[model samples]
Target chain A: MKPVTEAELHTYIDGALSEGARAEVEAWLVAHPEDAERLRAYAEQNALLRSLYNPVLDEPVPAALLAVRSHAWRRYFAAAAIFALGIGLGWLVRGMFITPQMLPASLPRLAATAHAVYSPEVRHPVEVTANEEEHLVGWLSKRLGTTLKAPKLAPLGYELVGGRLLSGPQGPVAQFMYQDARGQRLTLYVSRQRGEPRDTAFRFSQEDRVSVFYWVDGNFGYALSGEIKREQLLNVAGVVYKQLNP
Target chain B: MDRRLIIEHIPRLRRYARALVGDRYVADDLVQDTLERAWNKFYLWRPGSDLRAWLFTIMHNVFVNQARRRRYEIEQAMEEVPAVSVRATQSEQLELQDVDRVLRSLSPEQREVVLLVAVEQLTYEEVSGALDIPIGTVMSRLSRARERMRQLLGGQTVMPLKVVK
Candidate 1:
């Protein structure tokens, strides 16, 4: 029998060898304890590598990083260029402002996109249903690292459909979806702010047909998005703000 | 080009980057660079070919360039800071910290090769394509990397494949 090379030993551990080759290597390993021991060490090292870094896959990809796929986000290229030039992208985007020119780069866009994508889902709009309100709230609050309340929209003819944890620019965000008798849906998107925790008046940002009434209160940024009239959304937003604050 | 396909690969790319670069921020920066490059020249990607491998190849280029520049900066700063990992006297069982410390001690080339195979579970051909190294180089580097790690972390209790979690 031809000698199984060290490469074959590594390949056998990796499960990359063909069936015949693998069988050949297995036979070789049975005859050779030293090489088998070496293979086990290598396999253990791989396990360690996976254990150390696989958690990253579960982490929310930074909102800035997610925005790179948008062609409208040409500005991100400049940030990437700066990063490539040795400037931390984090620092370059530290003072991010939502100007009309940088509108696509705003948190409101993220909120609006989240609303558009989710509000239309019929059967599976939320990860946690409103039936398990406490569980939903607790799960999202833990993820967003803030005490979250699914505001009472029933008074305004909309019932809490449910809520979900979303990936935001800074970290995990909470989105609470509400539906009225007419089946019109609205989403309140809550994301944490990294800047100084100061309260700001509600700011309106319209993307396509998604009208978002957003505000910054303390460390959290809230955006209420719906396809309804601005006045109606504002009224709901007012009620939401009041219920949330109260 | 549908950018959505690129988005699907982001998690795995981030995983590889996290392993390739120890710092989460730096790892994400590499991922962002890869995303940006893939988005810009998305037309270059052959449709039938492996999108994950293509994205990974782009990540490899971004990582290598950033590492070259970072190595220069570290060299300039005279910051031999990686030595800070507390060495365990007894390798009774290789803890996460000990594993990380040993991995950092590896040469960057070996680290990437081994990680592509072990962590990402890429095939030898896939690893070669992703890292832009030949098949022979991948095996040689994997062999050398595992041998070095064996020497550094001798007698570690074999743990289950953590990927199961």
Candidate 2:
């Protein structure tokens, strides 16, 4: 048999050898048990790595990470148009353009709708639970195309209750839910805005059952919505904005 | 079908990312950025070509770029995962000591070569294209990584082989 090179040994360990090459290595291994042991060690390394991360294959893909058909391109163009028209003329202009019939999906309306739908759930409120804060933060940040922080509303008596990924009219949106002592829930809905960084001061909108305070800072549309009092929601929104921006 | 093709490879992309970054969140972030880049460059992907290899090539680029942006974070991640220690004596137990530590023990380039070859089971040619390194570099890195793993899992127990390259 030909002398087995180091590369060939590694090849046999990876099972990359041709039948003849594999047979030669097997024959050689019988004479060289040390080489066999080394080959076995390399095989074990592969097995260990495969077993360790193979679970990721079985993990249900995060909703934020799934193959979402880009449904919001229309809303994407609308939002871009909205921002383009205004030199920071902001969401009021957004409000005037959206007809009641079209409703066309403005930030606060979407935020409030998400809040109304999700906050009332007695169980299973979030897609990524708060305990997995790292994954939740990382997932939301990527989808929104910005580094997102689920603002610590702990000072305002609201604790992060986890978050979910929602497909909003304007691209992928992230809703982070926070709960107060009385079980009242609030959601901070975020959507990525197009174009350059432009600031839109806080815009307040009262939907059918939810009050929302939303604003656009740079490239993100943020709406803090809840069934809580206007003053209370606003206060929490202020805290959220400061924590996110600051 | 184009979209699903990208989605189909996400699991492997994620598993490789986890091995690369050493944290689930960071791993997902890597996968997300890879997916984002893949989408932006979707037109560049030739349909009939090895989609899996192309996706991995894109991920390799993303990982390299992100590593440049956050060199400090990668350094921190390179540390032995907290629970794994040299005290792990038995070869079997050592192999099981948080694959994170065993895998992260290799340098980034070395780890990439090993993972692509052993874990992903890509051909040496595929790894060369994916890492954009020469096939010779891939082979050398693979041997070095395997040798490191052998020592990492108590190679002292086995007699050393005669060939030293």
In terms of DockQ, the best-performing candidate is 1
Q: Which stretches of candidate 1 lie over 4 Å from their true place?
A: A69-246, B72-94, B157-165
Docking class of 1: acceptable
For candidate 2, give the docking quality class from DockQ: incorrect
Query: Top model by TM-score, which number?
Result: 1
The candidates' DockQ values read 0.36, 0.21
Interface RMSD over true interface Cα atoms for each candidate: 8.9, 10.9
RMSD to native for every prediction?
14.4, 15.3
How high is the CA lDDT of each candidate model? 0.77, 0.75
Q: Model 1, range B61-159, lDDT digits (tens) per residue?
A: 887788787783245224433543345444534477777766777777888898889998999999998888899999899888888777766545455
Q: Candidate 2, after superposition: displacement of residue A170 in Å?
A: 22
True lDDT of residue A150, candidate 2: 88
